[model samples]
Target: MAPLENLASGRGAFAPSSGEPASPSDGSGQSVGSGSSGRKRVPLGNSSAGGGSTSGNPAGDVGLGGSSGQPGNPDDPFILPQENASTLDKKLKVEVPMEIVVSCGPNGVVLHPGGYRISPGALKGKGAILAKELRSIVRLRQQVDPMIRPRPSIEFLVEPGGFDTYHEARRQTVISGLDWPVSLQVADTKVLDFFPGGRF
Candidate 1:
């Protein structure tokens, strides 16, 4: 027996089996025994179902017997198609708020804290949305000015061109340029008031 160290080190290496002289090749090339001396490469890639490599079987489609190139080369390899963020976001589908606008008419009453719906059924289409504003005015009546302002006015006018004060609204009644002092027939100004958030 060669020294295990010498056998391991490849230093004057001894043959694997005793008593048999070294052949043309030391038997590591193909089949492992003393009889066989060469290798026979076979192309049996078509045996496992004709499409094994090209048949949509994901794993078999690679270079099984080195027939094709490397496994991941784009030419022979199939990579899963993927969607980018925009496509994926559309696929997943999330809604996001963009902007907000504040108005003082039918929708304005909702901005203030403790705002309430006018009619309990307003949201359900049974009553007017302006109910809250009417309720608020009924609660606070001292601020009412009956002279230039209409009684129970749903909204005080800023006098069209834009006035900074109530006194300005009181004094500003000019219709427009080329407009005479002809009295304008107007409907009684009573608008339903509804705000959101305050209780009924």
Candidate 2:
């Protein structure tokens, strides 16, 4: 634990119990004016054997072993320790892979290979004969073209501060002739496609 962590947890040198001040000593081997006020001056260091009660080590103070030590305060609010790398790795979610099929078809620009059935409201425009033929070719290639490998799926780490950027990028991938589907997974659960028409 650090000094700041001690402060945050209400434990460092400045933290006093019951709002009472910790008695301090003067440099001239004498008690401060706090003695006249009937306050007992707490020893800055551990006293000799059978001398007095102990308040434990202070933060950044050299201990009997000659190493700087952090004081432990049972009354301080508890702070959860940071997770180790292995623990964090076990808690991480895996990335999902998806496919985005784009083509100009009889139903206009197709964003998903599942056809208009997936996004009926989004399929607009009276496509020309050439567009219909293009759809046939695109379909044939999808079914038989062994050379056409699947495009790598896009990934989005669903953190609080990154949602807007991920949302905008997902929109662009569907509408800007980019043939890649977004991969979003959270806590081992796969999310459905909610941006097909790019409305949500």
User: Pick by lDDT: which candidate is best?
Assistant: 2
Instruction: Encode model 1's per-residue lDDT on 131-154: one tens digit a residue.
Output: 433434443432343212112322
User: Residue 72 of model 1: what lDDT?
Assistant: 62
Quote the lDDT for 78 in model 1: 57
Minimum summed lDDT over a 10-residue window in model 2 is located at: 116-125
Backbone collision tally, model 2: 0
Give Cα distance to truth, residue 106, candidate 2, Å: 3.2
**Prediction-by-prediction clash tally:** 9, 0
Candidate 1: where is the Cα deviation over 4 Å?
1-79, 94-108, 111-200
Question: Deviation in angstroms for 104 in model 1?
Answer: 3.6
Q: What is the TM-score of each predicted model, taking all chains together?
A: 0.20, 0.20
lDDT for each candidate structure? 0.33, 0.40
Query: Per-residue lDDT for 197 in model 1?
Result: 46
Q: How accurate is candidate 2 locally (lDDT)?
A: 0.40
Clashing pairs in 1: 51-55, 115-198, 116-198, 118-131, 118-132, 129-194, 130-193, 130-194, 131-193
